[model samples]
Target: MPLTGLLFAGLAHADIAPTESDWGGTGLLQTPSAQMAQEGELGIEVTHVSPYTRYNFTLQPLPWLEGIFRYTDIDNRAYGPAVLSGDQTYKDKSIDIKVRVWRESHYLPDVAIGIRDVGGTGLFSSEYVVGSKRFGPIEASLGMAWGYMGSRGDIDNPLSIFSSRFNTRPLCGDAVGGQFCSDDYFRGPAALFGGFSYQTPWDPLTLKIEYEGNNYQHEPLGEKLKQDTPVNVGAVFRLNRNVDFSVGFERGNTAMLGITLHTNIAQATPPPKLLDPPPPPRPTTPPQQPPEQVNWADVSRELQNNAGLKVSKIARSGSELIVTGEQTKYLYIAQGIGRAARVLDNHVGPGIDWYTVESTNESLPVVDTSINRHIFDDLLDHQIDLDDFQRSVEQDAPQPRQEEVLYQATPKAFDGGLSLTYAQSMGGPNAFILYQIAANYDAEYHFAPDLWWSGTVSANLVNNYDKFTYTAPSDLPRVRTDIRQYLTSSDITMPNFQLTTAHQLADGLYGMAYAGMLESMFGGVGGETLYRPFGERWALGADINWVKQRGFDQGFTFRDYHIVTGQATLYVDTGVQDVTVAVSAGRYLAGDWGGTIDISREFRNGVRMGAYATLTNVDGRQYGEGSFDKGIYISIPFDLMLPESTVERAGFLWEPLVRDGGARLQKRYSLYTLTDDLDSDNFDDNLQKITY
Candidate 1:
């Protein structure tokens, strides 16, 4: 029997399990294949093929969609003398998107359509449609491709039959590289390609054979390459679930090698370490007598040490006891409340049957959590369950009885810390990577309930700023493009020094005002107000700033450039896939009128993946490299990797290109983020952690 017939015959009775390589995405080699990473999975792959090297980061943010960012370097070409004296190789960045058009069934194949280099230079641009089906241990795929992938032009442009415009492709030059070339997409001649992957009995290995479509007749930088044969062979060796190594011989000539590191970001395993002890055991029966009077000072210290809450005041009204405090630790608000309940049970008088815990941050009231003493005791004693307890707890506004003040503790007025800091910038013409390491000192002081001062200073330890010499090619005012100057001009700098005050203006409205040096690039005074009803799905806010650009050394001196910038923003929680969309219209620092849209999805583990884009009145040509500003960001909560719980998080952002247009002030605070716990859904989701 033929190979196809033999594979089909085995499919009838063979029982085979899919392997690690089977789950890796398409385009494993140079040709299009049919496979996809699992949803929520993230992978980073590095591949080398003779004169070209590629670094690819892929994220399956959705089940049926995959987004990829690739940075490719032409090992033989220079970045021009202006950048590193022509010592560094030329690199190009591109984005790829793949969508599963159809999923496989018993009799149907899995089909996918993809576009490569969507908003990048035309060097590696292509579009393809592919399908694959599994038979026993073998999977096969076949596809038609166009653009760079189909440069061989074995078949005429079939689409040209409908319109002659599809017969010819246009070369618009490198200046328009990052703009989406919609007119050129799938417009050139077409070619056919196919591939198959076979899983052997050996568990760690999988073999691949592909028929590449590229003829190598047209190469980037005006070089024509030779192709001996289209057939290529390769094999992948799984190092583990998170890593893989592969090698291939392509075009019957050059050899290719690659390594991939992958993991499901949503399901990452946290480090092994000790956690806080569980809440104290609940009383089994009514107390025989009233509890002894304990020192309030001792109770305050115990609350801070055990529950990670700093008590500001303790008061009683009738049959209720109220504790106003700030949370210093614990990522879940319920955990803090649970521990506090136990502390209060042992300290408060028996007459106080109701407990009200009012939480605050930066001296701002966030939420008031009400707990019935009997319900908490019932739940902790196993007489009631979580759902029952949740139905009894009350979350509402703080209405402190001012008639009596039982106890009040002096708040900590000053705190500071020192740590090492690192900052990086990439994708600019000056260098592929520029970075600085410094010793950072941060301190904060609270003067009043609504006012505070905070500052951060850095002393440079090591850097490569000497290589940052390229000037930005922006026609507008150099609001942000002077970053190279700021980075190189300072060895020691004060990045932030500001005084801020916040107020609860009304029932659902909050306000903040900030002055002094806000960020490294600008010194400004600004005020912002937000209207967000507790637990509402939408919010509205506005901010205005009057600012002057800071000196290159990051000193207090002002620069010639000055402007007033502001924005009116709207935020909506879409309820689908935990996604949130934010839209803002504003006057930017460059005096351009524009708007921005930011969309992000937060996972249950507190990992956020999102992207934002800004479009201004500046013309595409004048906006330079990327036409506009756009980037992707990921925020990871510290508790995901740490044993001790914390509300802190770190963020990483990547912008394809930075220009002067559509730039806004990098403010230090936002009301929406501060008031997150006010959302009832968020509180309810965390109620399971309640123990006391």
Candidate 2:
């Protein structure tokens, strides 16, 4: 059985019903309620409401907070027909945040405050506080909304009692809309909105009715939309646990339809189907007294074939046998240990009283796990249970004392493979979809334990880059916006080629140095150092780089652009919901001084999703389209999709718009990531899944 199967051995499997929600929101039609998705849940929604269509991606990064990214298209507005060919619509990108103030109780309702379109063109911006309560099979919600939601002026601004400035909202400032217009926030007239949802006897059906606050008078693109009535009705049909379908009659005139696909990233670990068989059972009884000579070669082969370990060296210190090796297969470190223990029992004699397994990654030591030979022997013999065996094991830093060297396996030098690669860009004025599919050849040559040379060559097989014509407007150096030129200029390209060396300088201190073609756009030299204590919640690091832009063909040729850039970074593992915050500040590729803040949540299955925003000295208008650089990315471990265990991962990043403002060097490696095994708590968590 796989490690995940062993961890969740007896859990029952059954159909899980989908939760009720609006188009892309967790509430009734047209208005938000206090409901929230389960923690670690990710949802993608596509909603169409006549003149406007919204694409939403939502994440419950924390129990008390929900983050949303949306791209809305105005069906009635065109993106300058004279400047572009074919039919194109004007699209706006926005971000939203909602925070739960209080949870629901028997007598109290769940309360939440939310801001919509915080830093976008003030087209659909709104702020509101809402509450929801459940009674029997029905749930009720109510709220007061301001800004676009209250544009009908249904009632006088009650907040004006405190200040006359709250009576009217100021006109939106600039066309480039990255600035947060706090002056207009919650200042205009307010209106009341409420809704109710009913769970029907049919398990998959949910009905909703809402009285919306917005009258649809102030629509995007200076078009006045008519609202026949304030009441809206909708229904959600649960197609399955991961999908939902919804349709509604909104504004008593327009028909709305949407679909949502959701999944719990933390619990999506599938059992491994392709794995090595369990280790051979322990000897039925103690072997004679001791073995005069053991076949160490056969023992090493067994450990490698069955335990997923590549032994570097094996030696004896006092009465304990130490095996130093790297794990290449098992996802859980303990599983590897469990299997290695059995291999030791069969090969070594009773003279070896203890077994010390030192695990490493790329030849760098990670942990030293010591096991009681007798305890493990008893468990394998069915005389004791696994829980008791686990209680007898100890783990700490490796203390390797040279005594008698038994064996040292040959190290692998060169490894390479070919794989399919896809690159895409969307939601820009030039083209709705621009993509390239290619065959990528990746190879790595290991020089020593912690040093290697790696590179990737991509050959385009299919693409539509000819349609990419829009030259993004930017006042600063074109560090990234000239992506179209790069894509169209090369049918065969080299994206990365670098020589990297990583080492442990001292306890809890790690360092990395690299040079060559760092990325497709730039090539240079850089180094990074990080100080992260074992089992600690925080870490600090810094990096500096001097790079020059590579030619459009992604070849050895260099461009005129060159700059020195770097950042001092801080990382904190916030105890809430496996969240991590990374902040970096320094100089950017465009010679601008700025900082970036990134917050991400790691699921139990190694799925990481996060958002980041970069701010620089460049003005919003000068930076062009997005005002600033911002994007959301998800890193998925290949093991989640493959039947076999792997250390590979794939990353997908979505940026609303690409610009030149806050471009950072795309370094291939970082010290913080290289030293991840220093986290002892993570090792312990994976150890708990061990089963022999």
Instruction: Estimate the TM-score of every prediction.
Output: 0.90, 0.93
Clashing pairs in 1: none
The global Cα lDDT (0 to 1) of model 1 is 0.77
Query: For residues 62-113, could you state the per-residue lDDT of candidate 1 as single tens digits?
Result: 6677777778888888767743445788888888778988998899888898
- Clash totals for all models, in order? 0, 0
- Candidate 2 residue-wise lDDT, 1-692, digit = tens: 12222222322224342353443557787788888877766678888888888888887767788878788888888866646735788878788888999999999999999888887666788888999998978999999999877677787888899999999988764787756778888888899999899989998889999998888878777888888999999898977567678899988889999987776665666455466475567677755434337777788888888888789988887778888998777666777888888887877776888988887766667667898888776775678876787788887765547668788777789989999977788777766678888999999999997889999999999988788888887799999989888888989999999999887777767788899999999999999988887668899999999999999999999999999999999999987777899999999999999999999988766778898999999888889866888888877776666666666777778887878889988887777775565555454666644553
Task: State how far residue 228 of model 2 sits from its true place (Å).
Answer: 0.8
Where does candidate 2 have its weakest 10-residue lDDT segment? Answer: 1-10
lDDT of 2: 0.80
Candidate 2 Cα deviation (angstroms), residue 344: 3.0
Q: Choose the strongest candidate by TM-score.
A: 2
Which segments of candidate 2 are over 4 A away from where they belong?
1-23, 82-85, 272-292, 376-393
lDDT values, one for every candidate: 0.77, 0.80
Worst 10 residues of 1 by lDDT: 1-10
